[model samples]
Target: MIESTFPILEVADMQRALAFYRDALGGVVVYSYPPDGEGEPVYVSLSTGATSMGIGLTESPLPPGNVMLWFYVDDVDRVTTHLTGHGANVIEGPVDQPWGERTALITDPFGTRLHLAAAISAPPDEE
Candidate 1:
């Protein structure tokens, strides 16, 4: 059986990715490899509450507009606006969905897509 999962995203620029994830998404950097080193960070671990994510620097070109990171937030409009103001490009609306969610699609400066959502109604309890 699986215990837990941590998603790692490869980024071309560590500083930009770190700023986006930490400053915009409110993620706290919990651990970073080569801490206080002279060069750019090779790996970084961040968390918001119980959810954790990792960012790693890569020499290869980053595949932008491919993967979407979904975040469930309290206020989709406010969060989307804040992110867009900080350089995220709005791709879709914060419109109400048939499944009962208000969502918005955005792309970061590096081309990573993000989906921000807020529940319009209580989600169905799991079986």
Candidate 2:
């Protein structure tokens, strides 16, 4: 058997990263460890209820312009409004695509582009 986990992002600051993940993206930190003797994380992880990922502050800096993470939501308008209210920058739309979803792209303070997608609700079939 095999199992896979989502990737971790190396950050310059742990708390800042945590804020973006938790606040802007609505994720919760499922596991975290305080700094070791060297004052660095032993381990830390976050989740968006179903998906789990890690964070390592010491690994390396995130690339200059890579959209490394994406988040899909049930309501793009509400989520994007909340994120924008929280100071996230809206980069793209609440535009409907031919693929059948309304999507909006935004960038966090840490420069991660988060894609908010909401599938159009289907109407009930009439007899």
Candidate 3:
């Protein structure tokens, strides 16, 4: 079961992405994969008013064509199984990630990337 959905943008640079989204666009960083450390984050979740998006660092920008949809689900395995049974292409995972999600990468019949994830950790309490 899916709880919510958001868009994720792939970027070549994490710092630049943060500057654009957080500084320029006035978005709030709701969550980041590394939480806090010396290095740059690999992924960040930002809330721009009512809408939110995910910024993910990639080795390089992918050739533009399609958008990715991030689905927050109740069960990663069950959702993955249902999608694959209907012919979705499984690229990786239903694996536990360092950021506390069990996730899977799949492309639907029309080649739209779907990121399915289930949280493995409780979210930090809101301020």
**Top candidate (TM-score):** 1
**What order do candidates take by TM-score, descending?**
1, 2, 3
**Range of the 10 consecutive residues with the lowest summed lDDT in candidate 2:** 35-44
- Model 1 TM-score is 0.86
Q: How many residue pairs clash in each candidate at the backbone level?
A: 0, 0, 0
Candidate 1, 29-62: lDDT as tens digits: 8989878666667899998666998998889876
Off by over 4 Å in 3: 68-127
Q: Which candidate do you rate higher for lDDT, 1 or 2?
A: 1
List the global CA lDDT of all models.
Answer: 0.85, 0.74, 0.75
Task: State the lDDT of candidate 3 residue by residue for 1-127, as single tens digits.
Answer: 9999887787777786676457643569999988778567999999966679888888866664578767676788887877675556798869998777889998754455778888998755668
lDDT tens digits, residues 1-127, model 2? 6578587776777777777777667787777777335565645787886788787786566663564566778889988988887667899968887667788988776677778887775534567
Candidates 1 and 2: which is better by TM-score?
1
Preferred candidate (TM-score higher): 1 or 3:
1
What 10-residue stretch in candidate 3 is worst by lDDT? 17-26
